[model samples]
Target: CVGGSNGGVKIEVVDQGIGIPQDDLPRIFEEFVQLEEADQRGTGLGLPISRRLAKLLGGTLEAESLPGVGSTFCLSLPAAHPTG
Candidate 1:
């Protein structure tokens, strides 16, 4: 994780598995949406729920991917300051 300009922190989750397709990237965070190759049993609610939780915490979650290469999911949140 790295510090953001606004006194927040950015955490990145990177994966080297098959990357997401450009066409499907936009909907990846939607509820009940899953990639064609994803496990058939998956409910596809994880990402959407995660994004909602991030927003509730005054943070943001985003993703970047390259087909056949890899993907990265980033979560940025406000940093906590220690009290004296």
Candidate 2:
């Protein structure tokens, strides 16, 4: 209302875990992407799929990280206006 534009909903996820490596940053949004040598097990399509769905809904999915510090992921979605 202030800017004559709708403000979207914001979603943020942060982890104090080991964080991410510099190299894997690029492919994090790609399908079948994972931190190589990661001792875990999974298809690694989660983020890619999430990003796709967000895009379809006029939203955005993104992430940020600091090697040994932590990481944060955010999702923004258009708000649904109420109908009288």
Candidate 3:
């Protein structure tokens, strides 16, 4: 179940916890975005920072979820170019 085309170990975060709501999902990655039901504990900066970091590292981060089901986040890095 674990395989990669990149040289670096991809870090995946999967959670079935109260999957993000359709409308909320899009804004969750924005700065200052937070869920009041979550006690507003979310700073909303976390995702943004993570995305920025991934971009800086030449990687991509994606998220998908189903309400009341679960969520899957993939942080994929570029495959290491083999050096002779």
Candidate 4:
């Protein structure tokens, strides 16, 4: 889902896949940090890169999950203004 408010835009990516454990949620944004419970193998650089890009753009990348239920990743950015 995506929406925009007066200050910024918010985008949420939700998945019904196996959810992450609360203890490990924060590690997902770390470089090359892959969870053993993952269904497939990955290099684990995606989230880290995504977070860095978000920060560079003056935005934020975050996540929330419940084990065995699902996960949600949210990206929020400030409203952009046109410059002459």
Candidate 5:
């Protein structure tokens, strides 16, 4: 889902896969950090890199999840302004 909010763009991505634990949410954005229970093998740089890129673009990336339900990721970018 994508829409406008607070004079900016709010994009949300939702997944039905295994949700992340509240305790691990903050660590997930760290470099080379992966959950022990994760099934896939990865270097764990994805979220960290993504967040850095979003920050460079003047945006923010965040997540919310429930133990058994799912997860939601939101990327919010500032609205574009026309240059004279």
Candidate 6:
């Protein structure tokens, strides 16, 4: 889902699966960081790389999760207005 904000737009990607632990949330975006319970096959570089790219484009990336519920990855970016 997507929504408008004061200075930007919020884009959310929500999932319905085993949620991430509270303790692991902080490092979820770090290089090679992955929870054992999650996909062990993953190299865990995706999130960190994505975050860096977002920042380079003048945006922010974040995640929120609830145990056994689900997780949501949010990306906020400034709105682009066309100019004549």
Count residue pairs with overlapping backbones in model 5.
0
Query: Which residue ranges in model 5 land beyond 4 Å of their true spot?
Result: 1-3, 37-39
Between prediction 1 and prediction 6, which has the larger lDDT? 1
lDDT of each: 0.86, 0.80, 0.76, 0.90, 0.87, 0.84
> Of the candidates shown, which would achieve the greatest lDDT relative to the real structure?
4
Give the true-structure RMSD of model 5. Answer: 2.6
Tens digit of per-residue lDDT, candidate 4, span 5-60: 77798999999988999999999999999889557889999999999998898888
lDDT string, candidate 2, 1-84, tens digits: 111137777788899988888777768898887686767767989999999998898888888889889998988888766799
Expressed as tens digits, the lDDT of each residue in 1-84 for candidate 5 is 343566888888999988999999999999999788556789999999998988987889999998889999989888877799
Q: What are the RMSD figures for all models against the true structure?
A: 2.9, 4.1, 3.3, 2.6, 2.6, 3.0
Rank by lDDT, highest first: 4, 5, 1, 6, 2, 3
Best by TM-score: 4
Candidate 3 on 1-84: residue-level lDDT in tens? 133464665778899787887777777678877766554386668998988887887787778888889998888777766699
lDDT of model 3 at residue 83? 96
Q: Output the lDDT of residue 10, model 2.
A: 77
Native-vs-model 1 lDDT? 0.86
TM-score of each: 0.81, 0.81, 0.75, 0.86, 0.82, 0.80
Candidate 4, position 75, lDDT: 94
Query: Alpha carbon lDDT of residue 26, candidate 3?
Result: 74
| Model 2 pairs whose backbones collide | none
RMSD of 3: 3.3
For model 4, the stretches where C-alpha displacement exceeds 4 angstroms are 1-4, 37-40
Error of 5 at 69 (Å): 0.6
With a 3 Å backbone cut-off (N, CA, C), the pairs that clash in candidate 6 are none
- Cα shift from native, residue 9, model 2 (Å): 0.8
Off by over 4 Å in 2: 1-5, 81-84
What would the per-residue lDDT of candidate 6 be over residues 1-84, giving only the tens digit for each residue? 344475678888999988988898989999987678544478889999999987887788989999899999999887776699
